[model samples]
Target: MEKQVEAIVEWLRQQLKQSGAKGFVVGVSGGIDSAVVANLIKRAAPENSLGVLLPIYTKPEHMTDSQKVIEKCGIDSLTLDLTESHNVMYSYIQDQLKGKNEFNESTDQLAGANLRARLRMSALYTVATNYNYLVVGTDNAAEWYTGYFTKYGDGGVDILPIVDFTKSEVRELAKYLDVPEEVITKAPSADLWEDQTDEKEMGTTYDRIDAYLGGEEIPEKDKDIIELLHKRSAHKRDPLPQYKRKS
Candidate 1:
């Protein structure tokens, strides 16, 4: 584990050196993935990494957990509360679709939820741009493979350092990096919406996802769900579709 951390830290240093960027800006959601990645970047660039906490209608516990990471890692951070902005955008969406009969508050919740993610990404980019830093994403391989992230929202980022690591591996790394125990054991949630949890929303657990991702056999039903998520979210993983034309 120590050697792995050394290699990754060196890789981040090399990437930043070659790109000639000032630093890294990461969004901390009080989740394991974000915490791990943010801390790793901070380790690599102690004076250059900036961890941004963007909360929109977030839970109190989430804020506490995020603060714990900051204290634990001693990483610099700035908090941007986007509750008002989120409300405005969600209201606009609901109002715009109200008369169309194709939308309702109940069914359009996902749109509003995704709006929160986009708003956070926008905020992260704005700060990164001002400081000439890269917006580092916290997505893991399991989430990326299954499309658990919002397209152009959480998926919008300048670079991802741990996209190849699974949830279990992330936990191991987090442990190695001295991540808070509460964060490690806390029910995985994006804190995107009230009462929302990762496993509940995905209808599966990280243990299952990691096992399958690691080439271990799993239940047929679980495999089906995983495959369906991958197939349905294929567009999210690729560049915009376009008509074929000769250059």
Candidate 2:
């Protein structure tokens, strides 16, 4: 574990030195992934790393946990409340659809949720550009594998360090790094909408995903469902399809 942490720190430093970037800019959601990344990168580039908390109607506990992580990791961060930004965009979209044929009450759930994720990404990039830092992403292997992240939203970033680690593995690493117990124990959620959670939305738990990913035996029924998720989310793991003109 020490070696793994050392390697990550080295990788982060090399990423900055090679790119001539000042440091890492991360969105600290108080989730294990974000906490781990922020801690690791700050250790690598203490003077350059910056953590930004962009809370768009975020839960109170989440904000508190995020603040705890910032203090624990000694990260330089600022809270940019995005509740109004999200509301404005959400309202604009709904109003635009009010007179259109696609108007539907059901659109609010997915539409508004994804918009929040995109808005957060936009804010991260803006800070990255201004500070000449790379926007470090926090998606773990389970989230990436299940396509649990919003396309071009949480998925949009200059660098993703935890993509190779499963959700469970992320928790273990977080513990090793002394991440707050509350952040570690909290149920994983995109928290994009009310009463939403990662396992609930994916219809599977991180334990199951980790078992399957590790090639361990599992019930046939669970295996079938896991396979389906992998197939459905294949596109998310690949480059977006593009059409090229024949030269």
Candidate 3:
């Protein structure tokens, strides 16, 4: 774990130097992915890293967890409440679709979630531009493989430090980095909505998925879930093939 962390840190430092980044701006979602990314930044560039907590009607626990992570990592941070921005967007979208009959509650909610993610990304980018810092992504391999991230939302970033680690590997690295036990033990969630859990929404657990990915025998029921997720999210893993012209 130490070796992996060191390797990633070195890579990050090189990227920062080559890109001439004065510092880093990250969205710490109070989840393991963001926590690990922030920790790595602290390890690599302690003096120049800044963590941002962008909460949009999120639960108090989410803010609490983010505070714990910031405290544990001892990095500079600021909180930006996106409630107003989201509300303005919600109103605009509602008015735009009022007479079209094209939007429903579910669609609105999904759009709202995506908007929140994108707003956070926009804020981070603005900060980066003003401060000459690079925006670090918190996405991991499992989420990327499953298309669990929002396109141009959480997926938009200047750098991704842990894109290759599975969700389980992230937890292991979190422990090795001495992240708060509460964060390490809590259930994984995107916190996009109330009472939502990642595994429950995906209909599979990371342990089983990781085991299957590692070539271990998986139960029939679990295998079905894994296969379904993989199939459905295949588009996220690759771009559409372009047609070639005759030479």
Candidate 4:
């Protein structure tokens, strides 16, 4: 883990040099993945690293943990509460869609959640632009493989440092990086809605995803669910389709 940490830090420096970017900026979500990223960026460029906490109707505890991560990583940080932005945008969209026969409450729920994610992404990019820093992402291997991220939302990032690490591995990295104990132990969530958790939303556990990635035997039911999720989310992992003119 120590070597991995050193290597990742070096890689981040290389990426920064190559992109001509000043440093790294990441959204601190009070989760293990974001906490790890906050630390990595600070190590990569201590002076230039920034951690932005964007809370859109998020729980108070999450904000507290996010602040803890920023302090623990010792990165220059700022808090941008996006709750009003999200509320304004979502409310307008809902009003425009009202009286439309095609509106579905279930779909609207997801759209609302995704809007929050995209709003956060926009805020991060805006801040990154101000400081000429790259916007780092917090998705882990399990989330990447399962496409459990919000497309063009949390998925909209300049770099994904831990995309190769499994969820369990992320926790281990968090430990090595000295992330807050509460943040490390807390149930992983995108905070899309109240009581929402990653595992619960995916209908599968990260343990099973990690085991499957390792080629270890898992329950047949779990294997099926995992495969189905991968299949359904295949588009999320692919390049956008574009029309090609015939040669």
- Across 113-196, the per-residue lDDT of candidate 4 in tens digits comes to 999999999999999999999999999999999899999999999989999999999989999999999999999999999989
For model 3 the local lDDT of residue 182 reads 88
Q: Candidate 3 at residue 103, lDDT?
A: 63
**Each candidate's TM vs. the true structure?**
0.96, 0.96, 0.92, 0.98
Would you list the clashing residue pairs of candidate 2?
A: none
Of candidate 3, the 10-residue stretch with the lowest lDDT total is: 229-238
Runs in model 4 deviating more than 4 A are none
Kindly provide the TM-score of model 4 when superposed on the true structure, using C-alpha atoms: 0.98
RMSD to native, candidate 4 = 0.9
Lowest lDDT 10-residue stretch of candidate 2: 99-108
CA deviation > 4 Å runs, candidate 1: 100-102
Tens-digit lDDT string for candidate 3 (1-247): 9899999999999988899998888999888989999999988889999999999989999899999999999999989899999899888889888869776876877888888889999999988898899999988777776678877788889898888888899999999998888888888988878877889888888887778877899899988877777788776667777899999
For residue 212, model 3's alpha carbon misses the true position, in angstroms, by 1.7
The most accurate candidate by lDDT is: 4
Stretches of model 2 off by over 4 angstroms after superposition = none
What is the TM-score of candidate 2? 0.96
C-alpha lDDT score of every prediction, in listed order: 0.90, 0.88, 0.88, 0.93
Index of the highest-TM-score prediction: 4
The positional error of residue 3 in candidate 4, measured at the CA in angstroms, is 0.2
